[model samples]
Target chain A: MYWITVLVVAIMILSALAVLLLPNLLAAVAASSVVSLALSVVFVIIRAPDVAMTEAAVGAGLSGVILVLALRRLGLWGLGDDNHPRPGDSLQGSGDDA
Target chain B: MRNFTSLLFAGGLGFFLLVLAADLPVGAAPMVAGEGILGQGPEAVGAANLVTAVVLAYRGIDTLGELSILFAAAAGVGLILSGMRRRADQRPDPEGGFILLAAADLLFPLLVIVGLYIVLHGHLTPGGGFQGGVILAAAFFLPLLGRPGDSLNHAVVNWVEGLAGGAFVLIGLWALAVKGDFLAPMLGKGALGSLFSAGTLPLLYIAVGLKVGAEIAGLMSTLQETEAAEP
Candidate 1:
């Protein structure tokens, strides 16, 4: 149990760092979901199942989808460089400067 | 140098917290209120899940406040993005492809069933209204995501949220009229862990579930609609 806790916490921290450090916004969003997933596991380990369920549903699930939708709307949903957006690839016709 | 200083400060704060933690009890969580609640909560609220008892009975008003906040947030989103949606003629995003469509169709019913089960059995389980409500919202949103052209009826969404919020308040008022305290557990708390148990707690959770589900669905649809209207 203690080892499981340690492993989950390690994964949570690593994924949290990946969320910050990853250059791609989409990858970062996925990393954030991993962080939330590991966090839910941590919550379960600590016996706060209510909190774990909320974190899994909202943090890992809805929040990721919302962020992805927003990213797509902003036309930032791409597999390219973080700094420069490709021309004509943006569905909304421009970069998200707003 | 500035970054180094900031990192040093963060490390110092962390060390200070760890040092403070080292002095505290390891296994024993000095649960003063928790001990009281564990001893007397079942008798007072009669829910099998003590967390539900605490959430719906003891901190009922706090839950009401949370509901109000969610309602306000949904309304605020509507107000802010009210005019920012695409016209009917303008094309929304295409269908999310075959895989998304098939998966959405498959998951909708299952998600709905699971969500309802979680919300209804809140008194007996680890999940409750808020968690279940989000899953319900996701279930509703997935269809829209698969086929963005078929828009959600905003009018219906508005009514559901409004009625759900009103029902929550009305239930609280009923409790007040009967017991002189708002949201106090009445309705006889039938049997522990049973479907009809926990007095007004389950009713409150149902109201909470519907309200949250509606609010989140509206929020997501509004966001999805704002895709083509970006200025």
Candidate 2:
């Protein structure tokens, strides 16, 4: 049981790390949801069905929607850094004005 | 350039996780069942779930502090956003489809009712304060996204919060008066799996759910108002 738990925990931790480390913000967010869902499973295994339910709802469900909303608010949903100004624009003084 | 910062953040997080794994138990927490009413007292604390018992009875003060923290955050958000109010720059959705609008309107009350049900039966079932509270906030938020200019009445939110807080304290005091112990079980301990078991835990979870819902809704409204005010 302990070894299985360790494996699951390691997978969750790695997935969460990938979520943070990945450059694709949406992928990162999806990874975060995966991590949360996995944690809920862990909670259930520990005889905390209530906590597991709460974790799944808030951490996985609500927060996923909220993060997507936030990402939309910030205009970071689909487009990537391809639209950013060329690095030389810093010398052109367009960088600091905003 | 942004990727560099993200990488650094990831590395730092990984380091922290390693430290946590080294220190904390990585396996299942040892489950030691609490001595039931026979060892403690008559189980009438207004809850049926033992988890609620640990949440609101054993750690009542901690839960209170958590609620206060949420309240403070709500207040801080309101203060910060209300001061920055301007004019609405974004125009209301003129092309809002009838289907979308109707769906939102139809779902709002149902969501609120479900959230309230979860809050009310927190101790009786597998839901509780934080979960129901967040759901309640979402019920309000869903409409805000669909209907542009709609806003919550701040007064109603204040009343909800005030009443919930007062109820929590009053319940605790009543326990003290009746049982000679603050936060003691006040209701009859019915059958072990019944809804009326576990004394005061259910009541506390309800209070917590209401308080948290009010706080989150208030915070969301404050932020939304500021964003709406921005032109």
Candidate 3:
């Protein structure tokens, strides 16, 4: 049972990483949340409901919100109508000064 | 561009997972520790919850050390943010975006009450000092967002911390003085799984919770004051 749980968690973590590196920050955040929830489930199986609750609250709840907020702060999500050449262009230009 | 690296990473992880799965144990049972100290015995140490027993009885000193570590972290946050402060004459308008303000107001009270509930029932249920304390800290953040100018009075925080600290010490001392061992259950352990069980553990958790809440709140207020001062 423990091994199965571990295998499930490992798969979730790998999937999360795949989501993270797929060039979409929102997708990455969602993937990370899945990983956290999976780990929390594993914690519950191990009879640590308190730890599972904390993980779900901190890892899934707070972290997802924080990630979206940070993404917004960095100007990732915006009005869909704008024709702005992806903001990464200006960011790359700024990097050239270094 | 990033696909090749990601693919390699994924492959490596898969290989590692296979290796770990190959080494699985068949069936596991609940772990038992210190057969004489934990199981049926004369001096059962009074606390019913085994986790609480371990925390407050067998490893009281370790818990004390953990509390000290948290204290150090809170102090470090204060020190780091204090030196980077702007001149007092240049305080910015405390107002932030409207959404942040309204959301903070709505969440603060709920967080505080829930945090208190968690702390009070820690001995009976799953939560304890650290979790409850963090929840309390989160509650304080909302107010900081909604009203940056209205700073949490450091004096009140300090007083609460001092009183809690004092109570913790007093209880420990009482246990030592009466029972000849520090942190021995001074009060009645009560029925198993009851709210009033675990003797001093619940009270200790409450003190630790208040201290943690105050420290985190102070840190939030301090950081906000500094950031609000920033452009």
Candidate 4:
């Protein structure tokens, strides 16, 4: 039981970090889904089945789909697209100009 | 430097939280025994599931607020997507293969049944309206995964949403008339652990399930339509 809790918490932290570090928006979204899934598992271990179910369905499933849809609307399926610059890319140039 | 500061802040916050958590009870605090909703829920609300009792009976107004928030969000998504002009030159989205289409067709009814079962049995089980509603939305949206151009009937969705919302309100009004309080359970609390128990809790859950399902399915359909349209 203790080991399982440790594993889930570790995975949750790792996936959350991956969401921050992943360059591609879609990959980050996928990582965030993983984080949610891991968090649900933690919720289950802690005996909150209702919260776990909600986290799995909404936080992981629906939220991921909505985020991907938004990303698609922004035409950001891939990392190598020059047509749509990432959020931080334009800010880097502004810093240099100043 | 920014990374270092963020790390320091996160570590400090984590440490603070850990210290606070260590002082708290691990599970089911003794002070909370035989008090609040946990104590009075099953007896007063007569719901087999304490969570359902608290959500639909004790804090029903909060649930209503949550529903309104969801409705506003769905409306905003619809408004944003509807304003985008579709290009005439956009190509049609491709349909899925035979296996995918067949799987969707085969699984759709089963998904619907499971979703309904979850929604209807909410007062007796761990599953509830929110979870079941999402499942229903997924079931409705599954066909679009196979056939992108195929769309759900917006009229049906709107009617379901309207009727379910009205039913929820009417039931609350009925409770006000009978018990002199909003959302008070009207029907008698039947034998515990039975399907027919929990007075008005199941009915409210069903209404919530239908409304939530319709709203989410409508949102998905609108988003899918926007996606299929030309930029």
Candidate 5:
């Protein structure tokens, strides 16, 4: 039980750091979901199953879907793709035709 | 410099939280003289789940406020997305695969049943309206995954939201009329572990579940519509 708790806490910390450091917005969102999932596990360990269910459902599931939808709306298909130019970046002269 | 400032702020907050945490009991403390909420809550509220007793019976006003907050957020999202026009080029696939559509159809009703079960059993078990409502929303959301352009009936959503909201208030008013306290359990709490136990709590949770489900489904529809709209 102690080891499980320690493992979850470690994962939570690692995911939190990943969310902060990951450059790709989608990857950051994924990391954030992992953080939420790990936190839910912690909640379960502490006997707060209700809170755990909510965190898992809302934090990992709905929020992740919303974030991905927002990313799609921003025309960000994937990592390092220049099809949709981000704001404030230098224009590469009609790359839309490329 | 910005990083240093942020680090300093975070460190200060962490220290403050640690100090607060240090004051709390590490594990289950020996029962004290005074009867705590956990000790007396079930008998008082007739809810097997102490958490439900506290949330719906003891702190109902807080739950109402939370509902209002969620309503406001959903309303804001709807307002923001109202002006967007659907793009002709971005229409969802008209002929979604048979398997995808079939799966969505198969899963929808099952999910709804599970969601209702959770909400209805809130007083007796660990599940509640909030979690069940999200599940309900997810159930509604599944079909949209198969057919992205298809939207839930806004009029139906609005009606459900309005009626559920009104029902919650009316239930509280009824409690006030009967018990002279808002949100007081009206009907007699049945057998401790029975389906119909917890008097008005299960009813309130049902109302909450419907309201939250409708609200969240509406929010998702609005967001999906915006996604389908022209940039």
Candidate 6:
């Protein structure tokens, strides 16, 4: 039980860091989802199944969808949109950095 | 200089968070109102899942407020996105590929079943209205993602949401007029841990499930429909 708790917490921290540090915006969003999934695991280990289900469903699932849709409106990524991010477009900061 | 200052600020914040985390309980849930609830919740509320007791009986009105908040947020988004609705002259984005379409078709029914199970079994299990409702919304939204040009009937969606919300309120009002307390668990609680157990709680959850499912689907559909027009 201790090992499981430690492992879930570790994954949560790592994915949380990755959410901030990832270069690609979509990758960052995916990493954020990972953070949520790991946190849900932590909730289970803590015997908070209600919170775990909510975190998994809303945080990992719905929030990711919302963020990805927001990315579309903000002109970050899409399949055939006119406002697709250009190759030289730096995701985080000045376009020159990439 | 500004970068240095911000770095110092960030470092201080991190240190503060570390301090906060250091003495936290490792795996056990904190005993607060929960200790008492865990002991007597089933006897008092007759819900096998104590969380349902706390949510539906002890603090049911708060849940009602939460539902209204979600409704307001969805309405706000609709108000903002209404003007951005895709015009007939403008082209909508093409549907997703075969795999996405197939996945949507295959998964929708399965997801709906799982969502309903979670919602209906909430009194005996971990998940309830909110969790299951999100899954239901995802089920409803998947096909929309697969076929971006296709649209759900908004009028039907509106009616479903309105009726669901009204049902929730009417249930609370019925409890009020009958039991003299708003949102009190009424009817028979039945045998504990059974599908029919927990009286009006399951009914409340069903109303919540439908309302949240409709609101979330409506919100996501609006977001889908209000995409930037084609160049």
Top TM-score hit: 1
Which model scores highest in DockQ? 1
TM-score: model 3 vs. ground truth: 0.70
Pairwise DockQ winner, candidates 2 and 5: 5
Clashing residue pairs for model 5: none
Residue B222 shift from truth in candidate 5, angstroms: 0.3
Task: Give a tens-digit lDDT track for model 5, residues B1-231.
Answer: 999999999999999999999988888656663357777877778999888988888889899999999999999888887787356676542434567789999999999999999999988888899999999999998899778778899999999999999999999999999899999876998889999998999999999999999999888877777743233
Question: Which regions of candidate 3 deviate over 4 angstroms?
Answer: A1-12, A15-37, A57-98, B1-26, B29-48, B86-100, B228-231
User: Model 1, residue B121: what's the lDDT?
Assistant: 92
lDDT of 5 by residue, A1-98 (tens): 99999999999999999999999888999999999999999999999989998899889998898888777666664323365443335567645665
Off by over 4 Å in 6: A80-98, B17-32, B229-231
lDDT of 2 at B170: 89
Residue ranges of candidate 2 with Cα displaced over 4 Å: A1-11, A72-98, B1-46, B89-102, B228-231
> On residues B98-166, what C-alpha lDDT tens digit does candidate 3 reach at each position?
677778878888988988998887766777776788788778666665564677788898788778767
Q: How accurate is candidate 3 locally (lDDT)?
A: 0.70
Candidate structures ordered by lDDT, highest first: 1, 6, 5, 4, 2, 3
What pairs collide in candidate 6?
none
The residue ranges of model 1 lying beyond 4 angstroms of the native Cα positions read A79-98, B228-231
I-RMSD for candidate 6: 4.8
**lDDT, candidate 6, B1-231, per-residue tens:** 998999899999999999988879966848998799888888777899988888889999999999999999999999988888877876666667678999999999999999999999989999999888999999999999988888888998899899999999999999999999999888887899899988899999998998999999999999888766333
Task: Report the lDDT tens digits of candidate 1 across residue range B13-110.
Answer: 99999999999999986898889999999889989989989888888999888888888988898898888877787767755656788999999999
TM-score for chain A, prediction 3: 0.69
Q: Which pairs clash in model 1?
A: none
Question: What is candidate 2's lDDT per residue for A44-90, written digit by digit as tens?
Answer: 87878998988887888777766765564445773222555433334
Candidate 4 stretches greater than 4 Å from native = A78-98, B1-34, B85-89, B227-231
TM-scores of the candidates are 0.90, 0.74, 0.70, 0.86, 0.87, 0.88
Better of 1 and 2 by lDDT: 1
List the RMSD of every prediction in angstroms: 5.7, 8.7, 8.1, 8.5, 6.4, 6.1
| Chain B TM-score, candidates in order | 0.92, 0.79, 0.77, 0.90, 0.88, 0.91
